[model samples]
Target: MALAAVVAVTALLVSYREVALSADGLRSQAAPAVQDVAATRLALLRADWEANWVKENLNGVPAAGESYQSQLSAADQSLSRLAERTSDDLGTINGLLDSYGTSITDGALYYHDDRPIQDQKFREAGSLLIRSDVGLVPRLDKLQNGQMDRAERLATMGALGYTGWVVAELALLVLALTLLSALWVLRDRCGRDYNPWLLSSLVLTVALAVVPLLAMTVTQRHLDNARDKLTAITTVAKQTERETKVDTTDARVRLDGAQTRVSKTSQEVRKELSAHEWQNSVYYGALGGGILVFLLPATGIGRRLNADYWRAR
Candidate 1:
């Protein structure tokens, strides 16, 4: 019974640790990486549209030029942040971005003198950004897809961890039953009253079982919420992309709204994940409690048996 109790405790602690790690990966690594890629795509699309507007208007408007530069800067910053989390080689994408910026700058220089050349330059830059196969936007889409896949896998692992928790609970139930049976046998055969040590172990075991289960339940809830938020952000981003083709002003409005949602949801995810930081301490405490639970039963039964042996001698 002591051995069974120890095993159950170890299993529960291990399972809980797995779940915590999965949540951390999703919150700290995968979700943010996805957001970064999405942001990069949106920024690049807006910049492309602004460059075209500049070419068509030929108004020498400072606002349009500034917007274009601002979007490029935003895309660059997003890519830089993504670099920290991803293992993918970004050398090619960075090179393309540099070339794209140069073409845009060169095209602006020819706006007054050579209209056709300026148009050609802008076309080259646009192709670098949204060309069919080699465009920066599509590449970022592929990267974001990879991040989404990773998040899905982590979520699956968390589900499996919960399954492990169920098994641990079953083991705890069996341990409780065994302890009760031992107490009853001692009372009937040896005319012993309820053993204090065994009684305390039973109570402690029940408490331990309930506490971790409650924690797991709460963790699962937070995980689900974070996932839902990520999904919403992705959907909004896609809609913004589609709408950008129809109206630039409307697209800008949608992009701003999406950015706000992303920012708020990201904060919420971090807060939820931070709640599990204390889990390591809880794990150690539960381990120590399991040892105590085992010891209590062993000490009680050992004393009773020793007393009987001495009486026989």
Candidate 2:
């Protein structure tokens, strides 16, 4: 009874610590990418707003004291930061924005007249800005796609934490079979009811199995939270950009809050990922292969060999 209790306690402790550390590492890895996603969406919104400003002011009539020039600038700055970590084609992104900016600026020069007039040059420039604005969204989508791929990979690795459940299950299955075999062997060879070590091993493996299932479940929940928050922020950004009459102050505040949540959750995933040791193939192979070495003797194999020795004698 004491041995079984000890085994259960030890297994629980090991499993809990392993799962917690893995979860932390995962959170840490996802943090930066989540931040980038938020930034990219924000940039897209600003660039579109810049174009909108040009459309509204096509007749040399600026939006009554509203300087709508900084959206694109903010977008450019955000993209520049994201480009450092992402393989996205920065040249294309920056080029599109530059073209839009140049078109709108050059077209405005045609509006030098004091009265409202849709000069041919102004119309052409405004059209060019619109075309560029439309094209920009697709390019931004492409960049976001690339980022999602990387995050998915990281999420998969973080999901490896769930494999602890699988491994523990396998270990339990082995223990179950081994338990049955031990019962047969003990009854035939020594008239014992059960082998204490085999019973202890069963308890230990069962305890280990339970924790990983819970660990993996928790990991999945966090992953979903992080992903949903990111999607919400991006969707909201697109909506804010598309709407012609939005409360800029309120929309901005909501987007900011959503981005903050995304950031927090991403950090949590990266932290879970950092705790895993067998991150690569070689280390995983070594850990798994090493299990067989201890497993054979720790189970009933040793007793079987001893039983054979006495029978031979």
Q: Judged by lDDT against the true structure, how good is candidate 1?
A: 0.79
Task: Please give the CA lDDT of all the candidate structures.
Answer: 0.79, 0.51
lDDT of 1 by residue, 48-116 (tens): 766776766754555557777888899899889989988988888888888988888678644635778
Clashing pairs in 1: none
lDDT per residue, candidate 2, 1-313, as tens digits?
2333334334433444554443443354334544665565554454444444454555446452133355556556776776666655678667766776565445444444632442444454444334453566666766666665655554444444445445545555565565667667777876666666566555545544554455546655565555555555456545655553356555445554544554565455455444444323322332343343236335555776587699879
Provide backbone clash counts, one per model: 0, 22
Which candidate leads in TM-score? 1
In candidate 2, which residue ranges exceed 4 Å CA deviation? 1-38, 47-73, 101-134, 145-171, 187-189, 192-196, 245-293, 296-300, 303-313
Span of ten consecutive residues with least summed lDDT in model 1: 55-64
Error of 1 at 162 (Å): 4.2
Q: In candidate 2, how many clashes are counted?
A: 22
TM per prediction? 0.90, 0.58
